[model samples]
Target: MGLRRLAAGLLGAVTATVALAGCTADGRESACDSAGGIVECSPDQRSAAPKITGELLPGGTYDVANQRGQVVVVNFWGSWCAPCRAEADDLENTYQATRASGVTFLGINVQDSRDKAIAFEEGRVSYPSIFDPGSRLALAMDIPPNTIPATVVLDREGRIATVIRAAVKQEGLQPIVERIAAESPEPAGQR
Candidate 1:
């Protein structure tokens, strides 16, 4: 009976491995999965951005909950992800342009060692990134299951307003932030 149980467990593990192996054409986890398959979350369907407090890469602590009353842009990235690398400058540029309008940006570094992630950010990304090697932040936000280089825009009330499942560009991000920032917060009771 024990042998049968062991065999079944092994088969299950193998089956899961095989299933995940084909989850992507390159065998890499898809960005959509990390983002919870949600391309966009409407204002009416918006939920609180997950509470993720963590140590920032270089140093300092960040509490996502404290970012209330501002348009918070949460970006999930990895040091090794090509799209993350490609979109780094665009994010920074947009942040610079939109910050005065009450927009803030936070980055979550996942699936990377601290050293490599820090090295990648050195002189490239100006915004702070939490070292979420296990993707805890992404999971907390309920982003699609396996996507990287995902971006989520949270409204002033810290409610999720949009989710972008791919690399973000300056042109695409700026207007979104501007529009969200321009809107007045929902009434206290409405929120």
Candidate 2:
């Protein structure tokens, strides 16, 4: 099927009660990003993944700071976003399936509280996520704040390999992941 048809097909099959403020192309940025408010990233998103830290959920103790030498996938979402809810399963599946390949998936729940975010995960998603309670991180990144369901793929060397600004499928994810795994680090003792 064509891209349009595939998108439509998938959209129709997915069910979500949460209200999506706006939608992006690949579910990485806020679904509602107006081309006008969206600012481009330095070195672009395909360059080195910027060094940053995010407060973890559950207890909010550990902060996921670095992405060096690992393929990190960051998904920006919120409990209020329908599309984000729709992609929850796919994201979890990707996380579980890609571990051996040295890929790590992290979620950034933009503009959401801990309770709502946790409910979303336990009820539907199985991956780990960070709660961006005050929109601080979103503002710092210069992305349109509250744009649920965006994703950023960082390469093994910590470079930004790609950004999926809308809902994405498994096929759309493999190529970049493959390339990242090719350069992934082996055990410390291994050559």
Candidate 3:
């Protein structure tokens, strides 16, 4: 059983890397019409993002529940997925842009390793990542193994704002994030 879990983790990591790569296609020429089988963002499909627990690298545990009142962009990815890698830079860039505004990006790297995760974030991506090797979190989110490189955006109050199971472009992410970051709860004194 232990061995099986380890294998699953490794597989998840590889898949995430590939997904990242596919998301990196040139934004100017991105297939806005399609994501090569991946789903594009839309209101009907903008379901609640999944929430799960994970192990922070170098030994720590964290969960999205801790991020209430702040907008969170949670991404499920693997090291071997092309689309995930493709969007790494954009993810990093957008995260940097929104962090100051109270938006945070949480990367849940599945089937991947510490080394690869390190390299991916150190180079261009700049967000804290958690490991989901056993896949309890991935399953909770209903993420198919092949349909990875997925992203879930949380509203300011921590409700899932959207789910994008495609090659995420900055333009696609920018507007939603901006909305979340600027979203404010109604004043308690108001009716």
Best by lDDT: 1
Per-residue accuracy of model 3 over 1-191 as CA lDDT, tens digit each: 99999999999999878554444323411332244443333322233445666678656888888887788888878788898889888788888888888888888888888777767667666667898766566555422323578777777655545557666788778777897677666465641
Instruction: Mark the regions of model 3 whose C-alpha exceeds 4 Å error after superposition.
Output: 1-51, 142-146, 186-191
TM-score of each: 0.79, 0.64, 0.67
Q: Give the Cα error of residue 8 in candidate 1, in Å.
A: 8.9
* RMSD, candidate 3, Å: 10.2
Q: What shift in Å separates residue 179 of candidate 2 from its native position after superposition?
A: 2.8
RMSD of each: 6.3, 12.5, 10.2
Instruction: Point to the candidate with the largest TM-score.
Output: 1
Task: Single out the weakest 10-residue window by summed lDDT for candidate 1.
Answer: 27-36
- In model 2, the number of clashes is 24
lDDT of 2: 0.61
| CA lDDT of each prediction against the hidden true structure | 0.79, 0.61, 0.67
Candidate 1 lDDT over 64-142, as tens digits, reads 7887787899889999999999999999999999999888999999999999999999998788899989887776654
Model 3 is weakest, by summed lDDT over 10 consecutive residues, at 24-33
> Which 10 residues in a row give candidate 2 its minimum summed lDDT?
15-24
